[model samples]
Target: MFTSLRLPQPVIDQPSRLVLRLGLGGGLALAAAYGLAFAVPHVSLLMALLLLSKPGPALALGKGVVLAGVLMLLIGSGVLLVPLLENYAVAALLLIGLGLFAIFFIGTRQSHPLLSLLLVSFTLIPVAGVQGQALALQVVHALAGGVILGAVSGTLMHLLLPDLRQLPKAAPHKPGVEDAVWLAVRGVLIVLPVLLLALQNPALYMAAIMKTATLGQQAGSLNARDAGRELLGSTLLGAGLALLAWLGLSLWPSLWMYTLWITLALCWLGLRLYRILPTRHPPSFWLNAMITLVIFLGPAVQDSASGKDVLTAAVIRLALFTGVALYAWAAIYVLERVRLRFHPAGPRNGVSTC
Candidate 1:
């Protein structure tokens, strides 16, 4: 339904090669997931886009996707072991620890393994005791579907358009293990208290997960101005966009209709997302907003009309964003002063080459 004339001028004039690949791949993955009734279709497009968005060889992308997919399955399945912690607080704390550790292994520099994507695949798991297995299985299946299809699409594009230009990338040095360890320590100290506190409030838990995942992504920049803007602006915009999707679907609900709607939205928003990027993997502002829309509003399209869930999610997201941003900025500010005051010996910058 996206006719040529309806597309934006930037899209028509200077279409991003990576964006085009992501859109085609995500759209196809979405169609397959919906058509086949995948367990967690909502994740299919997101995973596809995430994996395929990196500017690299198709084979390299495929390899990373496979590695990440296996990691996703392993991590998701590990949720089954959460009961071992006995205390819910202990479980949350352990999970936070696991998240921070992996966050280091993935490196916190300039987006090597991509911390945000890594969190969704491994870190943001729900510790629902026995049900954790089922949740994990669902996540793995959804991820598998996306990665497999997205990789295929990327490979195909590479074959067909060998001359296609890739996005410019910054080659930041890999962080030393000691630097990574220190960063992990900082991450745990900052995140553990918040994680425990968030666990106390069911409504606040998801927000905490979102906030922390975002924190990991922004760790490289430690730019409060950009991070705050991305967090607040994207979340508010995403919530509003989700409301629109819900309203539209509520009026004329149909399986095919909603599928088409989501597909188109993905394409349009994805293109927009790629166009606004100031760096190779800087904060994903509009994409985050679109994700917020899809994740929060997608369900309302099917559920009976009530503004309660959307409103609650919106508030939680905003509050947690504010809280997390404050902590991140405060931590960064103090760290800068310390480094300046006592020039500690380690990696000069926080970046990952992975």
Candidate 2:
């Protein structure tokens, strides 16, 4: 429940309030994550941005801590599969698939955005563990830290720029059982290939897992017609944004500059996301683009720090991301056609299927 604070009416009435909250809050989280030198600092930054994108009030500190603990517990649980993965690969893969479907089904039925986070942890932690248990533990720690960072940044933003008038929150749309099942299936198909690929080289495909997990969750909300544009288009837009940001950072390579650049990018996207900038695209489009931007840029930064060829690495990553998006688009098209053939009638209760 968001309550209005004693703030000026101008700030309350202007849509820029939400944009500012998203931009500033995200920037603060990014700065803190990198400043403290957390493992996979970009993960923390991405989590914070996602949290800030939610329309309602920030989670209380206590709840935030609890969420962090839950994230650690859930992600850390993946370590249990390491032995199975090494010993009984077939059974382990099947188990992971089942778990992914269950999580996607629950999230789709409930219309929860945190599904992306859960999906990432579920898919990423186990795969990373296959490479090494230490890497898996690091992934868990990074995600938990990200949750805490998100909570703190969200709370601070709310306090500093409280929404003086509470807007009516839209009731979440819950799909029918059949729709939920189909959507969850689509979500699984979108991620499963990438998950399998990541199992080969978890170190390189870690970011891909993150991107695919987001795509899987996003696919649930998209129709077949819009799947290509929303999925592939956003990936390209994000890649472009990351390229530009990397160029800007090159001009003045400093943490302060990096923070500023990221903040500016977030603000620009926030304008579109909050509808301050007119656009035909939905808010999810911009949100995905923002996530894409971070996903692309984070790895580039790591590559540069590790003395790798940034341009070549970025190009390769872009290609991989594009391939994943194209696959997601195709999966949606094929699945929707199959669903239509069987049912003849489309989704009931006005629920759209992918």
Candidate 3:
């Protein structure tokens, strides 16, 4: 009896340890993601995955990260005749067409799925002149940091969510032509918003429309009413976290503490919000405005950007950014709800084979 009991305790303890390690790893990944974005907010791998998939551990997660990183590096380096690939619109259209063909005929060869992801990433490549070696190096550095972070975070998540084997199977082992098309469509939808944003702001816009579009695709289709409920839950959680972090900053000038406090607060809010506000409703602009206020207030007070002056410049900048991001999310959420209500997508949610 003692020996049997010992086995069970060890088994239970092992997974728990793994979970802790993975979660820590994920946290580090998030930090790296944030750091990289500070330099070039476009193509943010952190926000990409966070906004899309359910957090979990999968063996392939690391591979996917490394693969994406290398691909981005290669493109940044101007390798594989990508730089010479003329006619930006023409080329993208061609690739989309080719992808469509692959979906129908080849039906997602083992290599197709990764290639599809690679193609999606290619949308970030500027159609202008070639990039210099220096630019390539910087891009590589940022991508490497993000990839490492994601690998660690994903590994940690795997530990926490140990039943990854039970992940939903792809639509069909055969070929997911419709699924791929849907993915491509999703990519277009996600990218379109950023593309428009870029037209509006040429300075800070990193031209990440494609990445955002792909992210929306990855978020999967919001078909049923439940889908709205989930986004509602997610947005509220993100909002609450953002608010708590602001509170911490207002209270003190500790960066690390603020970050940690916000992370925990977000987790708690995620659980609480999901349980309470279980329905998706259009959030009032006032609610968003309040969130925006907290974001600025926290940073300005915590950072002490204003020593001699009563008001800090950082507060102003923070307010601008917070207001924009919050409003954008709110608008997107409203649009999604509208789309769901009107056209109403069919029940086709599942992992993409291609």
Candidate 4:
């Protein structure tokens, strides 16, 4: 995408092209998905956006297709569980906890980076305000629609635009049962409390997002200090830009104008997000901040916002990701140290399980 301009030192550092690809592909996919008219357009596009973060193929082409199918079935199954537990709040919450545990456990493996999206999307099927067979159908269709569209668009993107970083493949390995269990424990520790907080709020307006952001970080990949600084800077800049664009729409006061405003805002935001991902870009939080806004504040992007509303949301989101980063780093650092002390010669595990 930057053929004329001399690429930076790590040619792969720039990913503005990827964001553009996501915007175009995600737009087309949303157009098709919205034809259903009853589906949540933002949900599908949001899924596509999350999937865009995942660079390589989805679980190997053939396996990914199978995995997608399995995910649909599992989503349907989750829908059934909701009604069965509606009369029992305890069971419902426990089910949610168990599901969170599983998502974290599987997510510990680098092989399944997108599993966090898959798991949360499926788990939420129960609470998607659906019931019975229709619930199953809707949940399956919703998730499948998004996942298929994302995968197709991603494939086309790879075919047309060469990957900025053609990092050579290394053999992927599965985490051991012990590693999975420990990771799940840490995730549950961090998530269960947050889940409880969300439950306390009647709307649960931001809980799922917070949980997803929290688990999105894997252990050992980025240090907490770097993650904190980057998150603070990026959230401040990106939120500033987003809130400003939001203010512009109130002046124009037309749907078309608002649409134009959103398109431009996303373009600018996408550039910032991509710039933040480059090697010089600090690790962690910028991308999470971007995604968090989409999931939480997307529907209102083109609408007028109260200064209080914007400020409150921004502060809450900044806190959410920052807390997640610190927790992730602490868990990794503490666990690794304990493991080393107990078995000083054991093979070192570099990955974080936060």
Candidate 5:
């Protein structure tokens, strides 16, 4: 009976399995998010993509539940700051800065993507709350829903496209305390300015906060020499893909078409990210490009549905994202220079070992 129930295996290799998982899982997440009309639907798709990026078994049900709970708790914690932000603006900013530093420090010391999720929660939630308590609550719900959707889609994909063999995981490098501190400081500098700006007009700059969060994670992995190319290049690549997708979807203008475009793009990027498609660019480049594509495309879709000027919004968002990327590159460069000036014999290869 078990043999009769087993499906034929079309994905035999690890790379093919990974690509299929990303494509199918991302499409399912995207379809579900928009089909159900969840608030901030793009976020759910983005979470799914992030989870699929890790080529391994799906998260267990028990762990997924715990992760969802923890994520909700962390993200909801931002609501507590709404009053503090209104009453003691200066103190609130300082406290947020310190929190950012600590989060980045922990991320640098331990190489895990959970840190990115934490950074996004810590940064985006409070900014949303500044606009209104209701909006903050909505964001919390959206984030928690995204986490659950990602876990479910990822689990389904893994079962459908299981790897033939499990590969041994590599041990990640941990930066020393001093190096971690420096990297953490750099990440804080990259994110805090944007967060402050978002506080001024949370509705307008909310998307920027998300982009900045991605930049902060990207900045942590890059050295000065490679920063500009990797940062700006990936942003541009994502924008170009978004444009192409928009044009393609405009011709068709249907939900299925949108999902198809997204799935195809993810498959292309996943091939590069998993090294199935040979390229000189690092996996980070492809990862960032895929993320940027989602971020850009999601908003455009919303604008169209709401009768906003999609083209104008896309152009403005592209410009804002470019500015953020430029700032991140400059911050990384300046910080690296400062570190070298003070510590003449420090490691010059990457921001942190991992």
Candidate 6:
């Protein structure tokens, strides 16, 4: 019926080229993600989703971008309601509880729970901290960042390969309901420490992230050695990239040149590590580093008014990653021992029971 349509033959004959093009498109999209996330306030949730879902095949990538954009818009509008709702703690708790309940009732039963989880978890909450016109600014920034990341990435993917729409679905893994719950519980447990850190020292956001990871059976279940190795691999990769970026900036002051050097270097490192890693651990780590480094550098380096001190921001990010990696390694190591001592049979024994 649609015989007038002409499909390009290049896509069928050269999938590799298509993937590469899409990946580059994905990279640019990720860059947008980094920029908007830090500049925007609460919309960081969408940024998190984009980072988490980037490894998926082309179809999933498209879905993620669309989902993120929709979420960004919804969240952007939702900010208007923040003023009507008073009491930050109460609002936060209510939103989180309702979001989780919705997830269990509606999201969990679905075949693709990850998307549901991302949307629910990220957009579920209202922005907290202050109660005036500033709220609008925060909301706009947050949603703007996420929306830009999603729209840009999705559009870029479409332009680069045009085949992302046709990618195959991934095979399903066994639904670990018990494990997920346990992991969620652990996540709750870990939040205590982060709360403590916030109360005691707000500067420990990175530490809070690592310490929180330790609270759950999710991260706990990975092989102890593998987890530690992964943390090291990922962190070192970030540090190396940061160093390279610093060098590039030192040599060539142009923002465009800096972007090219940093992006290419990070991608090369990520691809190389992916190829050489004995297991999937290093690749995962490298991927994490690549995602985070963009956030770490964009404003810190780009904002000329922030004393124009690139070295300081670079150092701060490096330290943050280093400290977090150390904590992550230690936590994973300890959890492994606990698993051995208590649930000797291993994670399959359900000792890492979420």
Answer with 4 or 5, whichever has the higher lDDT: 5
lDDT of 4 by residue, 217-282 (tens): 433233344544544455455446556655775688554554455445555556655564345653
Estimated TM-score per prediction? 0.71, 0.93, 0.51, 0.65, 0.94, 0.64
Model 1: per-residue Cα lDDT at residue 213: 55
Candidate 1 ranges beyond 4 A from true positions: 1-15, 59-69, 87-99, 109-117, 126-132, 152-170, 173-182, 189-191, 197-204, 207-211, 247-251, 255-283, 299-354
Better of 4 and 6 by lDDT: 4
**149 Cα displacement, candidate 3 (Å):** 2.0
Per-residue accuracy of model 5 over 77-176 as CA lDDT, tens digit each: 8899889999999998998999888888887766555666777778988998999888888778777777777788888888887777887787767767
lDDT of each candidate versus the true structure? 0.57, 0.84, 0.41, 0.54, 0.84, 0.46
Clashing pairs in 1: 109-351, 109-352, 110-352
How many clashes (backbone N, Cα, C below 3 Å) per candidate? 3, 0, 7, 2, 0, 3
Q: What is the lDDT of residue 352 in candidate 5?
A: 38
Prediction 1 global C-alpha lDDT: 0.57
Best-to-worst order by lDDT is 5, 2, 1, 4, 6, 3
Cα lDDT of model 6 by residue, 1-354, tens digit = 789998966543234433343345545654554443454421343343334334343434556567656655655544544543444655654554444334332222233424333432233223222233454455445544554454455455555545444556555343356544433443343333333343333332432333233222134334566666666566666567656676777686664565466546544654543353244543345445654554455445544435766666566656666665566557656655775687675444222211
Whole-model alpha-carbon lDDT for candidate 2: 0.84
**Leading candidate by TM-score:** 5
lDDT for 218 in candidate 1 is 46
What lDDT tens digits, residue by residue, belong to model 3 across residues 73-103? 6545433323444336456445534543443
lDDT of 6: 0.46
- Candidate 6 residue 343 Cα shift, in angstroms, is 3.6
